[model samples]
Target: MKAALSSVPEKQQQDSEFLREVLEGLGGKRKTLPCKYLYDEVGSRLFEDICEVGDYYLTRTEASIFANNLRDIASEIGRDALLIEPGAGNCEKVEALLAVLESPRGYYPIDISPEILLDAERRIKANLPEMQVWSEVGDFTQPGVWDRLSMIPSRKRVVFFPGSTIGNFEPEKAEELLEMFAANLGTGDGLLIGTDLVKDSVRLERAYHDSEHVTEKFNKNLLSRINSELGADFDLSLFAHRAFYHQLRKRVEMHLVSLKKHSVSIADTRVDFSEGETIHTENSHKYSVSDFNQLLARGGFRPICHWKDSADSYAIHYAQAI
Candidate 1:
């Protein structure tokens, strides 16, 4: 059952917000779209496919690290702590952690995609029948999402932010985001976060632009999402997916390039494209252990300990709200 908390219907309000952001982003000097929208139902499934691609190793590497050190990690988190996962798609990563946790108090998963979040809620109910789950459907970054979390009872609150989702934000924004996470927690509350380590450009490039073309589909899916959700006529065929590592920026930049000059209509708005012009889609920042630790500190968390994969391509840190 859908219930509205305000005069505006939830779905209609969301559509309005999406259309406004789309127009503002496309109207910018550098045409762009927020990466968060990339995970609309279809994009989320494609991302799952991207993770299975051999070229994209972040997922498997993190899992291996967890498989190796889950007990130690859980020991650090200790017992009776509530696990709150933002962007908790399918909530797969937490199943193992929850299994090992010593009498975990409960789980609160916040996600923008209702389909994935609901499916995860059902899975957790069946697999961990004793564990409590309170799932929220909305953007995890929104303050209201975290605010809603305050109502769930727990002995201690720990934010489980796996998958290097932190790297999606710009450095400044990342610091602010961590601070926001900190704002939602008390001192001694925990945070288990992931970060992608800096690697050779060859490896980073391959990760985003896989040979199997799944990443290509993932990138272009943003355009497809805009076309579908906002009534935009984005010609998916006219835009080519391009991804590469920027040496100086220490990040992978993904964009959609226009094959030819064209105009597209979105709702009642018309957006024009120049030949070869591109819409910057997303950035995945790479960080060294030291750099990310500093970032964690700035975000109001004192760095505790971290675990890394065998290849050192990824690192997951355990920090505390300070």
Candidate 2:
């Protein structure tokens, strides 16, 4: 496989240090966990399995929208544009774009997973031989992560952020992220973003808490990561996976709830939790079309087009940097 530029060990060290600080601070109160820790190689594989589960309709729905609208999306963006995908996990949705977009000048997949990003780049190059493939390994939220991206030699840049990854951030943080993306582009540059729509509670809850138990494994894998990385003795079996739709918040919160009163030691650190105490793992906030438009406006973008499935359960919006 082609190797993308590796993320420096210093960056990995900084990430670990940040995790330590967040854990220490949260340990003092109710324990909390950052969602980023959920994606080690194994965790990433489990998440992909979760996406395929029957109850997990988000991925299939989004893929369907991409498949149906690929030509229109490509035509709208014009030819020979630089297709840059942020948080591009596995590049599954991107393949749809590549299949339809005519002769893209370059394909840049920006992601934190160096291994996955490299493998994805290799696959894209093999399939789309005419397209130059570049990969960036860094946290998408960092300020200067895309500075090198600006140096890529393409006149038209089209940012593709699929799979409703934006839902991972709070509204304000999402707006900030969009603004950062807008700043990365010139006036006529385009953004194609996928967003999960506000849907019924039953369907939303099932999507997170899948019947196959894959999502559960994915959620609990974070503790396993802590055990491996920080020399922690975490009884992963003692934590039950919990995911539910919060009606008021309009989001699905994933948690790892203690099955019984338990004490765990991580290196020199020890923490105790009563039965049923949970570590807040992740929140995926759903949105409406108007809500999404407001977010885009806040980020200095003007919506050019929006497409949705027949049920209107999800949307793919194309916006232009204003």
Candidate 3:
């Protein structure tokens, strides 16, 4: 099984940009790294485990809502539209949607990791032999990342952004990304997005800090990845994964706390850690349907239709380019 994979031709520049970002993040006051880096092979597998864990309800709930509302959502998507999914991890939810979507011209599952992206594309093609799969390896947040969509021949385009991944960004940055999506599509094009709604604090917290320890392993894998890729000496056992909901911020914060005072060196960079000091890894902001709609508007999208599961645990919205 083969799939057309598109990646930036400039490998040297890509590496330079990665090292620069890592330096900027580690040297900052908060000491952080982009969550995107966490999707390396091992990290990706750990995340798949997280979605299935008992406490993590987002994935299962979202899939249920999509399944129930598949027909209605397909109506809004219309026929022969090109389906482009950003952060298309494993292409799981999209496969369910493809089962019902009317002859989509093509399916583009874009992700940052090439190995996982191609593997996912192959699986998707195997499942739906007739469907066209074009997977790309690049950061979808970059300004010109959507330029390749223009090369796909289709009158209508639907950007499928499920997994509530938008919550990973600050509201301001989320709006900026939505605006980028708006600029990429023509009038009447759609953005079919899944967002986790604000809910009980305890439930939200548990979803990230799962009892199975899968999320913990997933969080710590970032350090393991850095050590492997950048020649860093990080004793993974020296740090513990910590995640909790910040009531004031209305988001789940993930941190890798130093078990005790320690220091690590990466390439030519030296970073010192204090006992209990943490490197913030990711933030997932929960939202009310109203808050999300306002956010969509700010990004130049108008929510035309939406659906929520029986428990209202999650929502799938269909918005049009304004």
Which residue pairs show collisions in model 3? none
Model 1, residue 250: distance off in Å is: 1.0
Q: Candidate 3 deviates by what RMSD?
A: 1.9
lDDT of each: 0.90, 0.84, 0.87
The digit string of per-residue lDDT tens for model 3 on 65-125 reads 8778889999999999899888887888788788788888988777776778877877887
What is model 1's C-alpha RMSD?
Answer: 1.8
Model 2 TM-score is: 0.94
Error of 1 at 44 (Å): 1.0
Full ranking by TM-score:
1, 3, 2
Measured by lDDT, the strongest candidate is: 1
Model 3: residue 172 alpha-carbon error in angstroms: 0.4
Which is superior by TM-score, 1 or 3?
1
Error of 3 at 121 (Å): 2.0
- Go through the candidates in order and give the clash count of each: 0, 0, 0
Assess candidate 3 and give its lDDT.
Answer: 0.87
Deviation in Å, model 2, residue 162 alpha carbon: 0.6
Residue-pair clashes, model 2: 0
